[model samples]
Target: MTRPETLQASSKPNYSSPDILRQFYQRLFPFRPLFQWLNHGPTPQPDFQNREFAFVLPGGAYIRYQSFLSADLFKKQCVQMTPERFEIGPQYSINPRDRKQLRKASSFRPVMKELVFDIDMTDYDSIRTCCSKAAICNKCWHFIIMAIKVVDTALREDFGFQHILWVYSGRRGAHAWISDKRAREMDDAKRKALAGYLVLAMSGEQGKKISIKRPLHPHVDRSLKVLNPYFQDEVLAEQDPWQSAEQAERLIRLLPDKDLTAALQKKWDSMPGRSSNQKWADIDAVAEAGHLSTLSAKQLVDVKQDIRLEYTYPRLDAEVSKKLNHLLKSPFVIHPGTGRVCVPIDTRHLDSFDPLGVPTVTALLQEIDEWESKSGNMSDEEKAKVQDWQKTSLKPYVEYFRGYVAGLLKEESKGKRSREEVAIEGLNGMEF
Candidate 1:
């Protein structure tokens, strides 16, 4: 397929400073319908210039939309977050190994021309009462952003998806674009089921009795490609053509009922080998034995939530203390490892600051190195005293780095704390 035009050469207006976020919001208000998928609430009032939105994820890491997808034809065609004024969505897709490259090429994809689906809380009008905490509370924005990744993984692993596009709603939540041709023909039931699959919720009905594990209970790794008959061909040009709609319909008819569970199982059976299919059957047996039926396609896939606070700027950083102060004034510490900005209950309003500031790690580290160098040549006892002072003085900096790293690992399966958080915790406990 031909690649889209280069966004860098285009003359689309871009904003690099936070001061312009207000102006951008004004520009975005008129396009509210354009971002209806955000599900934050009634289209934000035009007066939302100074308001902030947190581009967050389920992993607890915020989406960093530094010049996010401006080139996406979808956004451009959608007429909401056009390249002319706003850069809608995260600056880059989640290809972590190329993190540096994405950071360097900071810009939004052209608003995608293709269709997109957004998940948000149905009750956006009552955001304050609804999303009070991190876990129990519901933040549609976070749910939408994070849920898409889970869906993307599912599509690529269970189905055969090579590319997907995403965009921010410029308010709360986001819009994701799937480039796969198969996506267009999906029925409402399948779409809804797909949505539920990605949300990854525990089976509330069964409570402790039900077990909901991710990456699917059977693990689609390696065996997944069998579902795509196109891959079986040894020669590149000899691959089986994608199933026509008529053909797909006929094949689908041969399956059982189209309920979420049945559809999912049908998809598994669509693959080549019955041996791998048995694994899915075994998985179902385990679920049934454990009484985990509540873990249906709806709870895990269908996501309907609202995004509350919209944020702009790079990822969470140490100096963000000053910036987020306007939103919450909590006595907060940013953990570099997780990039989670934690506020002590005593200083909960740390976000009240007008214009937030987030310092880069390089800048923070340089300051620490300078301070250490200046204190060199001192006696061990004197050095110990200085070390104590350093800890007290740089506590915020340490927390910032720790949380930042932690945020990076939000997508990983391991439940372990980030190495930086552990180190900081150890350092925090150390005596002078």
Candidate 2:
């Protein structure tokens, strides 16, 4: 497979500088759609004001507990500061004016918040070998795709959540925002339970990394079903883990019987010239033979399942999902390292969503430059296209987001009418 283009080309202008970043935010950021997204639905408009906003500056300086009275105000502040990163908190506080009073008051309750999940590529360091840090290549991108499939499936099928939003983390990961009413109302403990249920691996310097008991639960089984295709095609064929002797030996150690391990090791030693794919084929044959002869069915199943889990299971920042107060990098903010917009991912066509393909701040500016260079006498259609985010690759993602918000608003309106009808019936009964 061909490798995707890198973001660090010589021709690309640096947008990390404060001046260019400020201009980009002022001239190009889609404030209208963002306002609609945050203030969605037919309920009280003050809900958007209670949501906390945070910013991360150029030199690693942090700002928190910031609130905006309106989307216009939020947009103005963003254009003025042009923060390198912007974050939104899951929990909404009662009062935006007095933070201390809001926290201290017993009457004030920490109410609704979207159940969020953060999946960072750095967490898969042990499994991937191509690139590390913020760098990503096509070979390593399968992990992200697998992560999305697993989580998306579980969230929709198991938890019965609709209106899920998936956003590409401008740098090396992705985030999921579940806006279903039931999900938003869940407390911290319930969120913690959900996070725990999704995670099967433990993190530490020592001991086994992944542990699952016998009689594997259906969730794990379903995840494996979702993960197996990518594991076989991408991890096995493309990654070629058996190329290194250390890695090969690790695979051999997972075999159930000593004789089968010895057989595989001898075969491996004899075939020093074999390709990685051929070596894997030999190991697979031996494992299959052992299953028929000495190994029990469970042993063979466990070995294969362990291999899949080791390579492709979702590695989550459990804290992000568990804590209500934790803030996540907001969508549409430019990542300092990559300069790409934190655009939403339309999971309907998830396979086509590429991080490398996201429009960078520099690129958007260049697009504007090109547009301005043209003759001033353009048609109405062309003018409209050039003015908004339609000129950039962010159009589709923003449209998808707008559609989701519209759906929520429709539901909210329906609920309001139902409540009004019930109230009218109660008044009539009182008169009688």
Candidate 3:
């Protein structure tokens, strides 16, 4: 097993040195298989370690990954860059028992594929503009994640895809990358549209409903050709220059905005002129170069099935269950799984505090204010009684709110568990 500190040291990217790469690879071997677990999608192995796959460092140096774990540990380890062997501390050394325990914890999870859509963290200007302090606008983030889940769930239910993986991008948003064999062939356009729709959908409005009649944005179709494999087939079938022009004309006519039409024309002008054969290439060139046609075919059917069946009950059931699990784990609620107690403010209390009750809290407050305004007519005795009523009446509501907040604190305490403790508990009967 690799020591955590040694693994951490390897993250300081020194690509010029073969010695460094070799050291990093050696440190990563024991945990290399963990990538399979990290990934929730069909773990497609690249034929060669490609430049497209490299880690983005804080200073903009992308070190190509010879191995994933060492590379991940390297980024995390290097963040604290120190001259000593163990910058994080002496406690960072590897433990055989800990590695065994990590393996045991991971084994309980089902095998699934992993996929990533890592937007460059260095692209902070654009990311901040869109994400806006990580506070989502409209329904974009919700829709994207929901779309990913819907696709994953539909594939599992309708297409017998048993495994799906989802994770946060570790920055602005989340990634619902899928690995199911069925999703490999989806054309870039369809996938892109689904993702766009998920991201740009209306929040808290009727438009949020996913329906069969959901129309694809025209721009989504054009960009789809750029990303998905399935759309390549449609592009490939339209080999004639005149036919392609007609499709483009039709797509332009469908655009709702004149400004968008101008933008499309500008983009079209810059695109390289394709040879008759090249124009028809259905898949991304890099993916094609890697002989990934079979994977694309499998992904397309699954993707279509996912979009079409988004409204089905089994899919809804899965989604609700996932939400319920999250809700249960929240500190606001009494988490049944962890036996955590919740704040006891039964919202039912708010139901009865109406304007009509005499000697009632709200009513009494109104009466006291009115009497004070007309104090010229009243004796001192009336003012004294009103003061006494105000103090006595409001105390219970204030106390209830304080105790309600206290109960929430208790629930949070019960749910809190260290990572190591969580790792051990997830192992069930497995021995480390």
Estimate the TM-score of every prediction. Answer: 0.23, 0.89, 0.25
Which candidate number maximizes lDDT? 2
Give model 3's TM-score versus the native structure.
Answer: 0.25
**Clash count in backbone of candidate 3:** 29
Worst 10 residues of 1 by lDDT: 304-313
Q: On TM-score, who's better, 1 or 2?
A: 2
lDDT values for all models: 0.31, 0.76, 0.30
TM-score (C-alpha, index-matched) for candidate 2: 0.89
Order of models, best lDDT first: 2, 1, 3
lDDT of 2 by residue, 1-432 (tens): 336336557765566678877887787776666665666543327556777778898777898877777777888898788788788874465644465764366654556677899999888776676777767877887789899999999999999987788889887899998877788878889999999999877433222434567678888898888888887888878777667777676666555567777887888788775555776567568767662456676666776687678778898888999877778888878887678888888888888777787888888877776766673788777786665466655667777877877887676667678999999999988954
Q: Select the stronger candidate by TM-score from 1 and 3.
A: 3
- RMSD in angstroms, candidate 3? 23.2
Cα lDDT tens digits, model 1, 297-387, are 3442311010001010011111211111112211122222222222211112221211112232223344556766777777778866543
